[model samples]
Target: MSVADAVAPPRIRCLAVDDEPLALGMVCAFIEQTPFLELVGQHDSAVAALQAVHAQPAIELLFLDIKMPGLSGLELARVLQNGPRVIFTTAFNHYALEGYKVDALDYLLKPFGYEEFLRAALKARAYFALLAGGAAPAPVPPAAPEEDHIYLKVEYQLVRVTLADIVYVEGLKDYVKVHLASAARPLLVLTSLRRLGEKLPSRHFLRIHRSYIVGLGHVQAVARGTVQLRGQTLPVSEGYREAFDQFFNRWK
Candidate 1:
């Protein structure tokens, strides 16, 4: 082998497919900009992309759009099955849950910048790397019994809060108010509710609405459309009702 060939780093071969020319071009551009991703083909139709993937078994990743003419990206993905890893790109947020059901590596919402695209690409790279090493990707672990606290930023200082002491969290636009069982006033922190929810242990916390996340341990009652925690009633919106019911039923 040549010295250059021996020294060159490996890259993940990728394909970009979207019904729109502009969206396809943007995906291709992002792929080209990434050092570890090598774009092999860019197609404006799922049929063409399907052909390309079949012809080239070396392609390890696909940047696919979910909604396409004739053959949709979701249909193509189902056909491909275990053929190649996929990172779905689309404008609609409602497709996210379905995309995950099909084992998509990541979902990039439309008008996403390079940062979001790169984040998804890197996830694919890591999955490939794990496969190359002959090891299965690790599953997310459940919350440990010993892990019972988290630190939150309040104004200029970080205050440590015991996990069991939290009653609920209220989201206010860009900030969240953390209500504690022992405190008279909730602590206001400058962070999104979604972001903060990710930090809390999933076993203890559940998001019931876009504006609220409640501690399961602190919940006193559950009604038709609301959750009661420490005498405070919080509505469980339609979007989260199914998930909340599933979990609630499991404990009964």
Candidate 2:
């Protein structure tokens, strides 16, 4: 199925909450610039976000941090009077169980790049569309199933890019940095961090942080605090720790 066919809905309302001001700002900024998304408000603390939720009932999506100084994001979610759809953000992987318990729309690791963010957003959009009855059933595979790929808009041209050729993606303000084996420099695409991820294969990609995605094969080594791939060093977010272990253990 084509990417547009996979994502038929037009728009979604979103909010972001994180203890770190930079992280919160980043999420809010991204939401504001996205075509299919609206930035309802931003919170540096879960407590504050809760208050906003009460005042503004239009918040349909939440980009939350699992860890916060005063009240943890997960705890805040538990006490919300009328909660919006949650997309939990964290620096550690240990909270995956708790996050899933709440059926959070998506879980994001800290320092996640835009493409990774887009992937989570797409999943959230899909869920909301189904819940709202605004989406149609998945198109049946053609008589002969074909390999999946994505069409990316580069400047004025829509380029066909193979999913497997992707090594990693980075989020630049108002743009996405896409890395490919053939290109010397990563290509920048104008798209939401979460939106680009919708076109990628879930099994092959994982958001270890808010700003980076390490291809399973391209990953050369991973040690405490950092991962080495294609001669670049990538930091690991604390929230993804549990998920990282799970990922490494499966392959080893």
Give lDDT tens digits, candidate 1, residues 160-227. Answer: 99777889999998789999988999999999999999998776688999899998756767776888
Candidate 1 least-lDDT 10 residues: 136-145
Tell me the tens digit of each residue's lDDT in model 2 across 97-212: 99988878778765455666777777777677788787644533333433445788889998887655667888777889889766798877899767777666556666677777
Q: For model 2, how many clashes?
A: 24
Give Cα distance to truth, residue 180, candidate 2, Å: 29
**Global CA lDDT of candidate 2, please?**
0.73
Evaluate all candidate structures by whole-model CA lDDT and list the values in order.
0.82, 0.73
Error of 1 at 189 (Å): 30
